[model samples]
Target: MKKILGFAFAIALAFMASGCTMMKMGTAFIKLEPETQEAYAKMMDSIDTYGDPAKAMMIETKINDDVTNDDAVEAIKAITEERNMRVTGDVKMFTKEDAAPDEVKHARIISVCNLTTAKVFLNHSRYYGGFMPCRIMLVEYGNGDRFLITMDLTLAIKGGKPLPPEMLKAALIVKDTMETLIKNGAAGEF
Candidate 1:
């Protein structure tokens, strides 16, 4: 009976100490935007589903089997132009000569940007420059699999304290535009 009481006392002390630590951790997140929790939850879900932290932070779509790489690239370009965004850079990272016989056959990175939106974000915070000119990658593996991948923007959109109204609007526009570009581009839709 005495041993059981002593064990119970030790457990209570441990809980008390951990409770203080948990409270401190919780307070550290007080300044984050309310939506930050939801954004983090979504990211965690992605990590769980994909089993890769890098993959969780990206949005990827497999190109349709019928869609050629050139067609997909062209579709992405057309959509960017239609949406008032410019193709700032397009680099072919891997080509036949650059790869081994059993390696990636084709790999390209296309960068798109809206100058006005870019300026808006830069003016708001210089750190936003890191994300400037969003990029979409088209990669075709050796075995004939192809995919379009881009960074997922949930954390950028909601991880910090709430953005100003204008900034939020601009961010959402960029998000929607990128998502459309990837989804439609993969399907070869202009």
Candidate 2:
């Protein structure tokens, strides 16, 4: 009995250590050079200023230290999977030097929306409060290049309902605003 308890304890300790390691890794920030960090900061700031008509509604952009681009992608997938929303898109990268005029630098745009929700709920699904999904946009620039990624996220409703069209529109506007900042050389200014 003593030997069995000792083995069990060892297993528990190992499990705990692994869990801790995973948590640490998940919470860690992606390492960026000083210039890169500054550029990101400025680009975010420009989001509140440049993008189309919504620029007036733009407030100060907030940067989340714990929220890495990879984590954002995973979180959206995990959250939507519970609600039967399958994330199907990917982040596409664009460099400034290679991009055309009036283009963005280091842009990654991911589109994650629920076709299932729309098919099931139709127009009435917009009334569901938590059903309005989210889209996460991330942009990184360094070594004289910029990158951006966007992903859609949503929650499952009890009735298999979808988010409202207006909600989706707003999310798109926000993304466009970010793109505008990149186009205006916000990355270089930072």
User: Over the stretch 1-190, how does candidate 1's per-residue lDDT look in tens digits?
Assistant: 9999999999878887776666767876787888899888988998898788988788999999999989999999999999889999999996774555568888999999999999988998899899988999998877778899998888998998888998899889889999999999999998
In model 2, where do residues sit more than 4 Å from their true spots?
1-51, 54-63, 96-105, 120-135, 141-190
Q: Estimate each model's TM-score.
A: 0.79, 0.33
The per-residue C-alpha lDDT of model 1 at residue 5 equals 98
lDDT of 2 at 57: 24
Worst 10 residues of 1 by lDDT: 94-103
Summarize candidate 2's per-residue lDDT along 1-190 as a digit string, tens digits: 9999999999888987876666666444343222444444444565656653333322222234444545544544554455444555656555455644445445554444456444444455454424333333445544332233222121121112233566455434534433332222222321
Report the CA-based lDDT of candidate 1 relative to the real structure: 0.89
> How does model 2 score by TM-score?
0.33
